[model samples]
Target: MLETYRGTYFHPRTQFITIDKTGKVIESDNILFPLKKGDEISSINPFFEGLASYFDSKEDNDIKFTCVHLESKKKQQHTCDIEFKTFANGQPSLVIIHDFSDHYEYYQEVAQSRNESVINSQILELQNKYLKEKEDFKNTFIANFSHELRNPLTGVTAFCSVLQKTDMSLEQQDYVEVIKSSGDHLKNMIGDILEMSKIEVGKLTIDEELFDFHKLIEMLAFTYTVKAKQKNIEFEVDFDDKIPKYIEGDKTRIKQVFENLLENAFKFTTTGKVTFTIKENQRRARKVNLNISVKDTGIGIPSEKLDIIFNSFTQLDVTQKYSGTGLGLSIVKGLVELMDGKITVESEENVGSIFKMNINFKYPINQENTSLENKLDIEYKNSLSKEKYNILLAEDSELAQMAVLKILSQEGHFYLDIISNGEDVIESVIHNEYDLILMDIRMPGTHGDELTKMIRSLPVQNCKTIPILALTANLYDDDKKRYKKMGMNDIIEKPFDETTLLSKIYKHLK
Candidate 1:
């Protein structure tokens, strides 16, 4: 390597070049400088610590050069800046030495960019997938909404027409009863809608208690027996008394679950009977597991459609022939799960369907069970109304007004008057005093909010802090809050049951 040095000797290990004003190399040395005589360097290299200063210096001015270094067997790699300059007469002169290694770093940067691009693409794909699923959920909700709304609207329309007919025979009166019964069914279905809304929006609170399991089954059987009889189908409850007598759970909601199931059974069955058989495991200090099976001889579901029947708004072909909101089983499933229970079904086409549900729960001791006691008293008294109370009814629809009036009349002891719109409501309030008002949010001319504000603005002496309840077809939370803020004492979602409406009236009016 030393022999490679000649006049104004140059070595490759050191990148520095000692040069004169004529652009001739006095001395140059570096190991990694691989430059030949005609090779051109474009820019400064990594080893140039003060590259800006080197490019600005008079000794290296008018030059473009990059650093190059070489690996050695023993000595460490040396780094030095290379420079190529022009003489004052414009002739190119060069002296080169080793500089910092480029070492494939540019390729590593390209690979990193590629990986980031792939990751970004995956994130975008996931975002699009989520958006599509959200849209699908929205579509499903709309379908269920239409089904729930249609049932009550259909009843309100049909019953009004039936009640308007004057010339009616005994059979015609029976038809009217059927229409009214269907309307009541619609109201019950709407109550289920409100219950589901409460559950979905986390507004429903569970009230747990202990009650006789056998008594609950017996009551469900007796109630559904009449419904089955109306359909000309027999109803039976097969249970073993050996099971626990008292179970600590929300018996009211549990019974409601089975009642909904049995109702569905009777509604779809026209010819055959519906049987409820209870089987249980009696072990572990009154710890009971009961399977309640309701087998119905009705228009059975197709095997493929059976799975989706419990889904909201889902109905098979046989169900579409009759009247239903298609929310019965949906509500049933929700209530069943709320009790930490499981429900399943089996059906064969035209052969009927069977639903089997299992519940595991504990029984309470030494406390008097009000469920059976209250149920008996409920059956003995006006089952719909437990108290006499004054109620003001405000609504726009004549048909709805008449239906509600008939229902209240059936309850036997409600001091109720119907007002057509909010304008009449104010006039009625000026002269009369009432315990509670059932104000329809949607009226012909006046909106409920304006009416509420007007009611709130009267003189303190004239003002009444009466409970004003809203009855509206809309069941959204925002709608409920809006009415509540506008001085509504509470809100009863539209198309409520005879029993539920009367109960609410009794509660607030009293």
Candidate 2:
């Protein structure tokens, strides 16, 4: 044991010495400093003076002290800690010295690493906060821009309808038709942009409801038949008769998917026929899988472009021959996947292309077998009454107001009053009786949501129970939810047609 201890470097660096009761060295290692047997302990270093005093007092307690040793030849300094102890008889017996340089360096490295980790954590937190703020600013800008654009567009299309009704020459009518077509095209482009934005931010969601499958197909047929005739091409629809009459799904998004596919077909196929086919692919208890395809003999896509066709802002026609935002196929793919469906495409350049999709829907439980036409007739008959309805329209845009007046004037069953701001709307509601209120969501002085709450709290008899519909151009899903939460009976998006407007008004009034 003694030989092993002497062979190690720590044994020599950490010195041990034996002293007598009078503080005279009796034995020494002689490794740190040379000392004779008769030398006093305090003669080598002043730090030992306190140890000598403790020995003279006959103290038996262990004591520790820090001291620095200077090497004269190398001019280097070493720091150490020393411990002193005595024998059982209360006489000084031994001393120990330990080097502490490496321990001090180790503690310094640990502290530096801790500080760096804290700084990195703080930097990451700030970056995340900055990204969140940027996203919020972008969403707000898009919403405001949509509102500004749709308000004027509503006026343009509505007035175009009114102009077409009057007598005019064939050439003048052709000019009017051109203007209307351009406006419709612009409206579709705006819709595509907004839909893409919603999908990118993960805010879009599917809203399922019961709808007539055959009726929806019929409407699509009527719309595309007109387009095919205009382009001098044949359009055909093949619907399976075995499909159920009523199904549960998002009717609007389903329609949008087909519309995009058909639009693309018609746009590309000018010389050949375009066909739409829908059939039942499979059936289980309460669930049905549908196989839908749009086949067009058009200028088809190249093989290399097929993989990227569904990517956002991707267009195969790099020459800018076609008029579109390139967001149609992307939106279609997003909607299909969100509904838990799959889509595929097959194409050959200059030959043809066929886009196929499969979607599943649930058979509506407890759904009546009555036809849609009959149901509508029943509702219409029940809505007939001897009393005339009074409707108040709260709109700030003069152009929008003019368009609404022209539309409602044709119905002849209601007396309409118009107000421009929130204060006027409140005063009019308190003074007169109104069966329904079409309140614009954004206006001067106050917003529509706040006005709806205030009206609900009023003491007037009709204020609390009257139907209030929000008219908005901000059609984001979150905005729609907010409008409903703020006491609105329903929502009516801007740039709506006469059929849609009248149907909502009748639905709420009834």
TM-score list, all predictions:
0.58, 0.74
Report the Cα lDDT for residue 170, model 2: 96
Query: Model 2 — TM-score against the truth?
Result: 0.74
lDDT of each: 0.66, 0.83
lDDT, candidate 2, equals 0.83
- In TM-score terms, which candidate is top? 2
How large is the C-alpha RMSD of every model relative to the true structure?
A: 8.9, 7.3
lDDT of 1 by residue, 161-183 (tens): 43645577888778777777666
User: For model 2, how does the per-residue alpha-carbon lDDT over 1-510 read when each residue is reduced to its tens digit?
Assistant: 877776774345677888887788988887666678988877666767766656655546687876555241244445667788876675557877666656755765898999999999999999988987887777667767777888898887877787788799999999989988888888888888788878777789999877898889999999999989889999999999888888888999999999999999998997988999999998888889999999999999999999999998899998999978899999999999989999999999998899999999997654566434334533853676636789999999998888878878877778899999877788899998999899998888789988998999999987878999998887888888888787899887777656567777877885
Clashes of 1: 11
* Clash number for each model: 11, 0
Q: What is the lDDT for 271 in model 1?
A: 92
